[model samples]
Target: MKIWSSEHIFENPWELVVRAQWRKYPNKFNQAVEGIDVVDRQIDSKGVLRSHRLLSTRWGIPDWATKIIGSDGVGHASEHSAVDPRNKTMELKTRNLTFCSKITIDEKLVYSPHPEDKNKTCLKQEAVINVKGVPLGSYIESFVCDHISKNASKGREAMDHVINTIKLETVELQKEAKHAMESINLNFDI
Candidate 1:
């Protein structure tokens, strides 16, 4: 079993960070993630929102790895998340559904307000990787860990791109709304 962890601080508030996280996929930076589907969602009695989502990804595994695993590198994972609005925190857990016998990856992520800066949000991410019944288990574990580290960086970039896109869309909506209001006023005056 291999454990990998990382921490990052985003210069945006917790709310925005959570929004960006939900919209992170289908961005330019993280193309490996091909699709996402919401399996279930509900607001609990405590007013916390819980959601389950399935992710479809093409990890682009090397030919050697594909041949060994007898797979074309397509993978699926299920993610469960809870959002506590009162606490301003979001927690997500994901596990692989593909190659369960040979390899398992469990990942957890938490997003919350930074301890010292309310304007910033902090993300804590960790992944546990286990490879079994494989000839090169340790080597494969190491390779997967390295690949995850690289993808983590790209994930952050994707979040940033999504956040900026949201901001630009908001600006455009405001402009359109203002123009519509002006047109309405001009028609009323005439």
Candidate 2:
């Protein structure tokens, strides 16, 4: 299924803050944003899948005001999963501030057997947006140099306006989607 995707390139530190905030708290409102659940498996040198449970948890800021005020989160939950050879890793290095940006949203519905009750199943459809960037300009060449001084006073106001608008749009879209899903009887599990 097609998923809604949105992205903005950040040229100024203030813009970066906004982008980071959205990335850090895509579901700050506790809405179940759609996406695939990845279960990673690790492989040993002998090419055998390891059977150990990777236990990890990440913590995050829980205050709406903090998000609105542009306060970054406190901690990140460690990802719990096994690593496998099927995973691909790419490494690229460059001087800061030279890059392109892209965001992709994917939606899918999935079903898996309940861990506690073998006979039961769980169904969830998620919308996930992945973001990537490569620097496009030097920090000095970008707006940072010219706007830094003014940003101290103007950043907060601009951020508040942008964030408020985004929050409102998210709420309306979520409500509409939820209602449509319910109307089709696809909002809950079978």
Best candidate per lDDT, number? 1
- TM-score (all chains, Cα) for each model: 0.94, 0.23
lDDT of 2 by residue, 1-190 (tens): 1222222222222333323333432243322222322345465685534332212222233588457635443321122222222331111111111111332323332233344654333333333333345244343233333332342224334534555566678799999999998988964566
**Model 1 C-alpha lDDT per residue in residues 37-155, reported as the tens digit of each score:** 99999999999999999999998988997998688888999999999999999999999999888899999999999999999999999999999988889998998999899999999
Cα displacement (angstroms), candidate 2, residue 148, comes to 4.0
lDDT of 1: 0.93
Instruction: List the lowest-lDDT window of 10 residues for candidate 1.
Output: 65-74
